[model samples]
Target: ITLPLSAPGIAFSLVLVFLLAIGELSVPSFLRYPVLPVLSFTQFAASYNFGAATAAAVPLAALALLGVLIESALLQNRVFTFRSIGRGLLISLGRWNPIAAAIFGLLTVALVIFPLSALFADAFSLTTLHDAMQRAGASIVRSVIYSAIAATILMALGFLLAQLTRDRGQRLVNFLTLALFAIPGTVLSIGLVRLWNSPMTWFIYTTPALLILGYTAQYCAVTTRLSLAGFFLIPKTFDEAARLSGASWTQRLFRIFVPLSNRTLVCAWLAAYILCLRDVPIALMTASPGGDPLPARILTLMANGAPPMIASLCLIMAIASLIPLVILARVIPSRGITG
Candidate 1:
């Protein structure tokens, strides 16, 4: 019973870490490691062998698909059933309150405060920040614009997929999204290149549009899950009432569903934006010669740049990632919402 109840949360955590890890390029590339994604990149970039690259990616793609199947099997019996918040019993940590508080304080200081302190210390100078910005300003803007576009696209796609899966038993869409999420960025990039690096699709293949598609493909599963969870909170009666009142599908969707799903949409958009913003592998592989995103630019510069400048660039990226959280903090309180 407990396992079934906790399955979704566990699955979400596992998928999150797995996706992040599998798509990563810098650490493995820098360490000269033979991780799947890095190996694929090497085959393509170092040897310029598209066929070899595709062949190298086959096993990685198969493993990712296998993982997705395992995830589905584990959660097959875990239905989406939410209970009223008021139904749960609350335990007051009266005796352990101080101890719990102390533990949290220590963790916050160690995990959050300490790392941020070092970043600030290394990247504190205004001159360095300005220089960093001046040097990679275009890439910075590209990262933001591309990520925002990708996030918007993901939210739209997520809502449609979530609605389909929820009301029509089209669970295959959900499974496909999960499978796509499991694909490493390098493997996906190879497929994207093969599909588009031709005369027929030349108009799009060499453009930033390719990176946008990669972002959408890589992160749409997150938004889909978020949207599905949001759909669960909305009672079926609302839709039924709207239909009875002669609301068309479009009317019911915009008039009822969209209004109720604002928070979920916001959360999904933010999550997707952050994922795209921090991504490097997808951009590295898909971005045109001069269209590299900020993270990719940083990785490239790290090879020859000064330590302080690199640190500054990294700090800027960290701050950029926090912008969504800061927006949520301000907007949620202003709207009288609580966590």
Candidate 2:
């Protein structure tokens, strides 16, 4: 009973991780693993074969769609409610508590602590970071601006779509975003190039707007999935009561739902922002020449830059992303998001 009840969360994790992995560029590139994303990226960026890139990405997107369909059927989402009246039994980790703690600590050290320790050690001092700022300041500024705008757009889209729960619109949206995410950024960039590179659309393709579009396509799933979980936690009775009291949809959504799930919305936006800010593949493929974002700039610098200078840029990127997220998490009222 408990396992069945946890299906949505489990499925959410699997789907998200699968999509992110499919589109990821760095790990596979570093390991020289000829993954589909990397293959598609090579075709577009290296060979300049937009057709071949599209062909590669389209099949992956299609496979992902099939998986989404399968998930939809197996989950029987139409019958699943976030506000279910029946609760699952809680299983306590009585004897396994120590073992679980050990595993958790090990993962934290390997994934987070060690990597950060190395970056900090290499960066050396304030002077190096200051020099990094001078060199890549414009790229950093563009990254922040571009990511913030994309995040805001996602937050709005997520909230509106989550309100359409159990509807065809929600299902269609889930399918589209998942499919878009599964397609590698380079392939999506190739599509954008073909669609907007002509004389009529040169203004959009030539400017930063194209990068924003690419970010939107790749990261829409982050906020939408988060919003669905967040809004679903709001008891339907709250919305029903508001409706019966003659409150408009907008009024109820803002006055009641928004206030209740404010933190989740903030978190959704933050997640999207971080993904956009640290983005490499999408920016690499779509950014105009000389206007590379921080991540792309870092990739370029790796060719010839000093190790300490590279470390400084990496540290700056971490600080730029971490500080805003930390501030928002602490400052925002966590009244509604219990978990």
Candidate 3:
């Protein structure tokens, strides 16, 4: 569960290295000078200085407060106001919990809102936003095309595989699907690279076709699983009825299964498309110079210390990722696919 959730982030980080490498080319001359070299030194010095000051101030403040309370008690010659102190402490503690919870909530909100705010803010900037939009526009278009083409191929294969198998081989097919899910994008990329590094596959390796192949391989199981689920939802009666009515397997599949499973088919395609769009590790590892995806492009900005541009690109990518999700949402409502 954790693996699936973290896979995207891990893949994002891996691709980010490549993005930064590209962004580093744009570093300003002044920042490249002595000021840049001293950054680490300044950070280290500030940490130690702040730590010492905080340490000294906390203890000193504590002692001063203790002394003040003691003096006040002594001046009144009242050894202690136990009841009053206890009531005040209880009141303070009662107030503190809600305040702390509010603060915690605010912090969490800020963690989410701030970065997004910064991204929007940066996108409004004339120069960086223009550059990001121009670059991202091209990359997004290419990636979408690549993903769509790959997903279509994967969906066809998955549908055929699902149609061919029955109870006896279903377990084996499912195990193979699960195996594909378990394989990391990096490992898949390596396998692809090895397979295509040969002379006969040289043209395939260097083209956008290679990236498509990698995506199809990675996401084929997703399509299979979705198609399988959709297939199961379809009654066996449809097939049997079609056969009794003099329909061949192909005609039955086309006339009944395909029409009835339209929603599932669309969903499977959408799922594969989303997975392909978000794919970073395999794309990054296997992408030829011509086939970089949007995620790969955003990482380039992050690596260059261009947080503003990176934020902007991230926001755009977030929206891009959500498109399929939005479609899925709209789709489910109409299809009666409920939780």
For model 3, what is the error of residue 14's alpha carbon versus the real structure, in angstroms, after optimal superposition? 23
Please identify model 3 stretches exceeding 4 Å from their true place: 1-114, 337-339
- Please name the candidate that would achieve the greatest TM-score relative to the true structure: 1
**For model 1, which pairs clash?**
none
Q: Write the per-residue lDDT of candidate 3 for residues 1-339, one digit (tens) a residue.
A: 666755644553444343222212113222443222123222223353433433333433343334333333333311111011222223345768998989989997798777667778776677876777776778888778888898899888888887887434655665455444444454455557667978898899988878888888767766776676677666788788888899998898888778877777777788888888877756665678856888667655465646667766777777777899899767755443211
TM-scores, all candidates, are: 0.86, 0.82, 0.65
Span of 10 residues, lowest total lDDT, candidate 1 = 330-339
Candidate 2 similarity to native, TM-score: 0.82
| Tens digits of lDDT, candidate 2, 1-339 | 878877876886687577667778867875689988888888888898877888878867666676667566656544222332345456789999899999999999999999889999989788787888788889999899889999999888877777765345777777677677766676677788888898898888888889988998888876777778777677789888988999998898789888887677777788889889998888887898888899988877877787778888998898888987786666334333324
1 against 3, candidate with superior TM-score? 1
Better of 1 and 2 by lDDT: 1
TM-score computed on alpha carbons, candidate 1: 0.86
Give the 10-residue window scoring lowest on summed lDDT in candidate 3.
Answer: 77-86
* Tens-digit per-residue lDDT, 1-339, candidate 1: 666877777885686577667767888887778887787898898899888888888987887887788777777724353233544665568999999999999999999999888888988998888888888989999999999999999999998887767876646776788888888888888888888999989888989999999999988888888778778778899989988889998888788778888877887788889989998889888999899999999988988887788889889899999999787555434432212
All models: lDDT? 0.82, 0.78, 0.63
